[model samples]
Target: MKKLTSLLLAFCLTLASFAQQAFEVMTKKPTPGSTIVIEYMPRNTVLQGKKDFEATAYLLEGGLPRAVEVPLKQEGGIFRGSVKTADSTRAVFFAFAKDEIRDNNNDEGYYTALYDKKGEEVPGAHAALASAFGNFGGIWGLKRNQQKGAELNKKEFANTASQKKFATEYASYLSQSKDAADQDALRKLLTERLKNEKISEADLTQTRFFYQNALKDKAMADSVAALLKSRYPAAAQQTELVAQWNKAKTLPEREEVYQKFAAVSSPANELAKNRLEFFDQVIAGMYADSGNYEAAKKYLARIENKQARANALNSIAWKLSGEGINKQPKDAKAGLDFSKQSLALVDEEKKAMKNKPAYLTAKQYQRNLDNTHNMYADTYATLLYHKGDYEQAYAVEKAAVEGFKRKDASMNEAFTALTEKTKGAKAAQAELEKFMEEGKYTPAMKEQLQRLYIANGGTQAQWTSYISNLEEAAYNKFKAELAKQMINVPAPQFALKDLDGKEVSLASLKGKIVVVDFWATWCGPCRASFPGMQTAVNKYKNNPDVAFLFIDTWENDSNRVQKVTDFVAQNKYSFHVLYDDAKSKEGNDFVVVENFKVEGIPTKFVIDRNNNIRFKAVGFDGTADELATELTAMIDMVNAEGGDVKKGF
Candidate 1:
């Protein structure tokens, strides 16, 4: 007995040591409804040397997965946190991040299966894990693996309750799978379920989607749809309403469609309320386009959700202000009114504080509210400034700057311009100089500052030196930050057709440094980032070792190539645009983007000579010079490495 006890103790110690290497779970056999303590050791992971860390627990509860931010406390060299699993918790996937740096266990993610009293994996646990690997993983910043997810999902299909519960996810997996056998199996399963009348409404709905979208079998999909309409008329009507709304081109047609839909859909239905709000916003925009401010305001007033209404009003206000002040100058009054309404709505929301979404933490919710308020206030101030209300604009912009802590560049620029109007050129010059030294000024702000400097008797040489010093300082700071985010991941290889139909392959550019940017024509951030991208491309045009390739993905138009061509030509951007037109056997596209595991557009990857992805940048912050500097620094860093390191994945 002593010998047996000694062996078990040794085994347990080994297990504990292994677990402590990266993450340690205190509860060895964590069951549903129990709280589990997790200790994260970031000694050698991507989050190494980060002082603060955040933990997001992706929990599967009641057949639905939700992300909950779990607070962590630093204990010596590790961070510790605990999460309470609900009785229905099937699995939990943990993701750790410090701002943009994430440690998703190198994309495999850190997760564990929940158990029952009998120590067996709970029902739907595999399905939840599958979702963590496939569908929900990308949304949570974890790499998606559809094949692995589908394999896991296959285990739960035998359980009828689980099948019904996860019908949508299962159908999604079936649609994404490129295997002919998998497709055939899904069709067979659907036929069997339909013949036996064993499928639920959810299952039937997903089945129709699979046939229509994935298999492209319109006749079969229509047959299933008709059956669904006969069985679940309410769900069918909701779907048809959306289809009709999408088909409607004119405002009157949309209004008629909404009236028909409203007559059938109940006010109690959340979907109905969302559709009504959407229709109201669309109609309001149409009226505004036609210069009918009264009709627009009437439609906007019908929107029930305060935040949504405020957002719609702010969007319209910003659009009108941009057009009227810069181009037309006649819609300024209408924009000001809309801006006031938006500000009032935002103020009311701040007072109420009862519309916080469930997904955000209290702190996050407050931060979002503050951001929204500041954004609307900036718009209001801008409109006021454009309308020649200098004093009021200064006051509103001052409050916004204070609220933003002087971090927002555009707001600071607006405030500086207002300061010139309200105070004097000297006061504006002083403010601009402070913002420039703090690296909180935009390119437009810099131009304004230079104008002020030249007007204030400062020499061109002095201004040039001042700008150069600031640029050098900013470049150094950005380089240091980029150095910390450096990684050595293997770049996925591809041979794509460029705009000229000439094939370009990663293997062909073996000795050159490559910058691959994933974007779509519809992405605002992507379009906004192009100026900076153009700057970087121009800077490297003479460098034979550097190459930039912009791959357009996720576009659904039939004339996608022509649209992309026209956009690039119209913008005068000299970019070698590649079309990501590879499709799956199921006819689903965005294949290269999927392979790269990119969750969003405007994601750029810097590859070294050996094709290792040294850095990945996501999103654009609307700073052209900063983006150019950052990309230049990344390329220089990779070039300095000389491609000597071993390849990694």
Candidate 2:
């Protein structure tokens, strides 16, 4: 459970962010303009080249982003890669993300953070790029505790002498030893700074971090803690709660401190309510882990918030009722009771929604209610499956899969339309060949295509042989054959509504280089590639010749736009999102997703100004810097040629 970080449940984030420092990328001499071979080094102890880690170079050449994946190889202790580029490139951007590692989706290896070697202790981001990458996956965003001398913004350094003086001094002091005489000097400096209210927030916080995070000396920590209490008595307890509690490294220590607080904390005390309720969750998990379900149930009943309690119960029930770490019994028979209770509680809570709370909108309440139902349904089905109730389990799974066949409806509609208008498979195969040439082939559509391959029942080997060789020689000839076919196929026309309820159409974006991405909120690699997509959006922010449309497909939400909007807001991402009608008129599943035959998430298509489909890319390398680079190169080539569309290659 992601516990609430209330001044009351007391949550503190320690150990720094794992994703941010996955790789350390540095530029060699003659960095930006020169032909620099981009390299990535695993600085953190957790990384060893045991996994596939990639560093994509997004070099700015010809005023557009060009992405090149530098092939990485492990040689003993080193993980390194390099690439050749033209000298005309202005700047190179690098990002790291992980691929399939250890049987889990590891996409953290591709986040590209920007840093300028500027003479300021600012977060490493270019003005435009920083503005684009919302928080940069914590790779470049500065933490609150890291701000020492007044939490000044990056631009504040330009104010000149005093700001620069303080910045330079702070940087110098960063490496200084907190020895006896040094400690005395530092204490005097901070004491003076604390008197100035302007920087007191940063000063007191700085003092604590310096002693606690850096020095690790208990005497210094105790001395500063006393000083902080004396200076800011009202907020003294609040400050110590996170600072002291976050330092508890052991589970026993954490449990001891939580229990101590629980013992003294009054149940009716408003100040302790958030913390006490949160403590119940923590303690319950601890007890349950030790095979004490009854004790865990007792704490679950103590939760004051009905919805939060129901959600927590549902989470535990789903885990324990399944065959994972939470599995208590072989078939999870022991968890059936918990699951049943959780289902009942969630239903009861839903019926009790008499008044839409002031905190939640009617839409938000409905969404929450629907999510509760979905969670319970899945849990109930899992339990049924485990108990040998195959029929019911299949029924539930079937219903869910039918709804998810939003993909089937979309693909069939587009294919049906193509079949009706073209000369059977001959013409349809030409269109499909474009996707195959770009490696955006759909394996699921093979059966459908094979039936129409030779019209009079073609052999399986024959169908496979026709699309065989991937060599450059064969590909060039295939493109030449494609050139003989339709040269300027209009982007399959589509009219969809964006998140703002405004209609966006392919026809409306005819004069621009339209880039379309088919994705969903649940798709892991899709989200991993969002940062790189955002980079492309930023690149063309001021350009009138290019447009990026993120078509949100495979959405099961009734309020599709709102769901997309809420997700975008929570992530602080900026993208032009449009929803694909899950069930469109004319008996279609989805108009856009089908028209483009986008059966997979994160498939991207580029249409030039002449309305010629210029590029098609399916899946990404879990990078913003990489995607932006590729898009930039394509857009630039199209722009230079004045909309000369090339055959799929």
Most accurate candidate by lDDT? 1
Candidate 2: minimum summed lDDT over ten consecutive residues — where? 9-18
Runs with alpha carbons beyond 4 Å of true place in candidate 2? 1-252, 264-271, 323-331, 354-359, 395-649
The sequence of per-residue lDDT tens digits that candidate 2 reaches over residues 397-421 is: 3343233332222232233223423
Clashing pairs in 1: 324-329
Model 1 per-residue lDDT at 524:
97
Q: On residues 527-591, what C-alpha lDDT tens digit does candidate 1 reach at each position?
A: 99999999999999999999999999988777788999999999999999998865743424677
User: If scored against the real structure, what TM-score would every candidate get?
Assistant: 0.83, 0.34
For candidate 2, the per-residue lDDT at 220 reads 66
| Residue 281 miss distance in model 2 (angstroms) | 1.9
